[model samples]
Target chain A: MRPSATAYIYIAPAFALLLFVLFSPVIYGFWFTLFRIEYGAPTDFIGLGNYVRLIEDPTLLPTLSRSGVFTAACVVFTIIIAMALAVWINRLPARTAFIVQMVVIVPWIISAVVATLLFRWVFVNDIGVASYIIQLMGFDAVQPLNNPTGAMVLLVAVSVWKRIGYAVLVLLAGLKSIPDDYDEAARIDGANNWQIFRMITLPLLKTPLLLIAIVLTLSTFNTVETPLVMTGGGPGDATRILAMDVYERAFTNYDLGSATALAIIMFAGNILLVMSYVRLARWQA
Target chain B: MSTITLSSAARARATGRHFVPRLSWLWSGLFGCLVILNIAPLIWGILTSFKGQADLFRFPPAFVSFTPTLENYERVFLSGFGGNLGISLVNALAAVVLALVLGLPAAYAFDRFNFPLRRLLFLAVVASIPLSIGAAALLIPNYVYFASLGLTNTPIVLPMLYAAHQLPMAIWVIKGTIEGIPRELDEAATADGCTTFQILRYVILPLVRPALGAAAILVFVGSWNEFVASSVMVDSPSLRTVQPAIYSFIGFFGREWGPLTASATLAILPILIIFALFGRLMVSGLTKGSVKG
Candidate 1:
């Protein structure tokens, strides 16, 4: 059948609107990097000047590495926990599994600010549950928020806590896609549960695992909300990772050119992840 | 789903001896800890909201023994949280509506017809899902651009941006669903002399009701729980959404736990209610949107 011209009519408006509101600023971001911007006012174009300036900037490298460490911890922990939890959930009766999923997903469904606030209450300096427990243990009560290492640890823990549910949902779906015969056949062939999981299930889980990895990596790298509320990149900037750095520089320092340069770098990384997601997703299908 | 030749009794027995039965104790223990870890915050927050400041600071905490008061609720409402709640509802509803308005027809078009650049167009929709995830990278640029145009602090901009951000996922989900309506249905409708738009409305729409529900949930949750975009897009106190409103309460009530938790609980309850009602569909919607897409 001949395709209708109305197809374009149906699609064009939505895509055009998306290109304008959602995507145009990204193009404008590229443009902003070439200019010195002061509070939304742009000076003359200085090609690659912003990128060059960042090379000598001391804060840039540490922030990048901090974000790297933070992101790595989160991705690793979230994947491991989510993979294990999904496997366990898959073993349950169908009705029970859904209920477990609902309970598991509440944190993820709550706003990031709320999630951070909730955890912060648990560790509040003088009158917190965790602090009370420490005192009860006969070890002088401690304040995790005020300590640098504790702050970083708390940030990563909170992030991983919120993200595990979504990852499990994705992986469980992947687990469901595998034919029951593969594992059942392995069972009949004298394979133990551990061997069957290692050989049949893990191998088949490759695509979803990679998908979850990419998704978590993107979300973790892009997140400023978690750190913004929990620690506000404070305690001598100890937890000031790259996303927060860009946000602080752009909003707090009002250094548009440098923030734009750093953000462009971040945006470049995002594009790579998006490319991988598209390719991997297509391959899965 | 297994392709085994086992009889019904054998299959039932195989199911009974499902993998990792020996690890049942370990699994249950881990699952219990996780469930507690995930839900304790919510339960504690609710408790903290109602406690008097004295009870809030009590040693060893009061789970159910504390005299719960409505003072915090009074404070939250008296301090104009109602406005923020209304704004959050407005923004989320507008986003869901706009995303659906654009997404449904485009999805119908894709499933039924082949057009120029169809594959590329579809890929663009898929790519948008990831773009929304990495949107923080674009925040500064978006803020600057919006500011340059004097569009910052405007009401329409936030919902429109939210809608556009959700558009791709909406289209991806609806496309996956609308594809399942066998073309014979459309052909049958056509044989009865139905027009294109008429068939889409009368025949296709009802068949894909779950898709519509799923897309609505995705867009609603995305917009409702959104803090970063809602914060950056508008600075006016009058335009604050519930998430940012709860966040701003930090500045207002620093170290004052009562109103903070009250506002927090208020922000959480509506979404939780929706989730409680439609959770299974939401979960299926998620996998259907992603795995199928």
Candidate 2:
């Protein structure tokens, strides 16, 4: 049925507010990117100059590589660990399983900044318990956020730890969606547990796994807070990812034109990735 | 042939019995390791937060402080730090409310109606992701725009920007939840002579409450931890959120570790409490909204 005029009335306030607050700003971003506008000046049409400048920039390649590496490593770690956790929890009796699951999920809900702060404390040179433990285990020192490689490793580690809970939950949901008859049938056929899981459980879990992978990849690519708070992209830009680079160029250097260019590229890339995932979903359908 | 089959089947059963318990033990061991790794940082932070600065620097570290004082807590809570916490909570809560108000009905419209330019409009809304790349990317134009409107440095600007940034995701999520409610309910309401607003208010609103709560919590947590935009948009010391406050505590040389940790703990408490009470719903809410949307 067609919506009544009153339906239009109900939707009006929301549309008006979104137009002002959300839509206008986004439209203005594209407009600003095309113009050679400083923070406080009349806009001049620059055409594709900003985009050209972005292509010619030296730092973009390394930043992209760093972001890619971060995403790949973090997604791999998150998925594997979350799957293991979900399998373990699935084996438990109901109530205990739920309590343990709740405990695990706590980290996911914690604020990013807070997690960074907590991890920063844990990685501090002398007084940190983690550092102390590592030292006791015969390491000289663990500079988790101080060295570039160390920082990247820690960033991925933190990302995985914070996110594993959600991954576990998602995987559990996927596991529950699978029919027990498949497992029973495999058992009756004298198939081993590994063979049953490999053939049935893994295939059934592909969709959820793909969803988790896509979300994690996007999030890792877009992440700013962990590196921002934990390392400040420190030990001399070793930990600097694309998003931080974009922020530094725009805010620190006040290069609106180039910053917008980078923003557009990043935006395009994310959209493409998401669209690819949608295509995969459609293919499965 | 029968003897061979029976012997192989018995060997297979024996092997399966041995493998199952061993695999179970291995999985449990891995999960236990993860639990330790996950809790390690927070536990360390809590311990360090209680230590004196001198103790913080002591070699081998002091896991158990000989002397623990309320000094750091006092500095954080009584020494003007609480004001920053208060501002963060107020800004985050206000922004969440604004986003929900602006997002819910739009979500309903998208879920229920096929208006002109529907896909295009929805795509426009979903494209807000990149706008959040950094405060800097949008800050220049926003600064100029807000200045022209006489809203720069005002409390309104941060929430407005946050609400705008968060609206798309919120709308998409609520729309997904709204779609999950079958259309027949609305038809029934209409057949009973209820107006659209009456139907939404009486029927849709109550049904979507769980999704609404989930969106509210997510938005609130996002705004509370928001740093880049708030830092750039609001320059006044009193207007800064908790994240920037933590940043400021660490100057060029070194950080005030004790009070910083205390403040960090304080900042995390509200979200933790919310999660503690609504943990399961929150997870399902995130996955449900995110997976579908």
For every model in order, what is the number of clashing pairs? 0, 0
Label model 1 with its docking quality class.
medium
Which residue pairs overlap in candidate 1's backbone? none
What does candidate 2's lDDT look like per residue over A202-266, in tens digits? 99888889977876777677777777877787778778888777777766887867776676677
Q: By TM-score, how accurate is candidate 2?
A: 0.88
Provide TM-scores for the models: 0.94, 0.88
**Candidate 2: global Cα-lDDT?**
0.73
Q: Can you tell me which runs of candidate 2 are displaced by over 4 Å?
A: A17-23, A37-44, A144-146, A277-285, B1-15, B117-152, B176-188
Model 2 DockQ class:
acceptable
In candidate 2, what are the lDDT values of residues B1-293, reduced to their tens digit?
99999999989777878878887888788787777777777767766677776776787777775477667888776656788888888898898999898788878777777666566666655544333433333454455456556787888888887777677668867877787898899999989999767877898999999889888877887788777677767878878788777766655215667887777778778887887788777777666644552
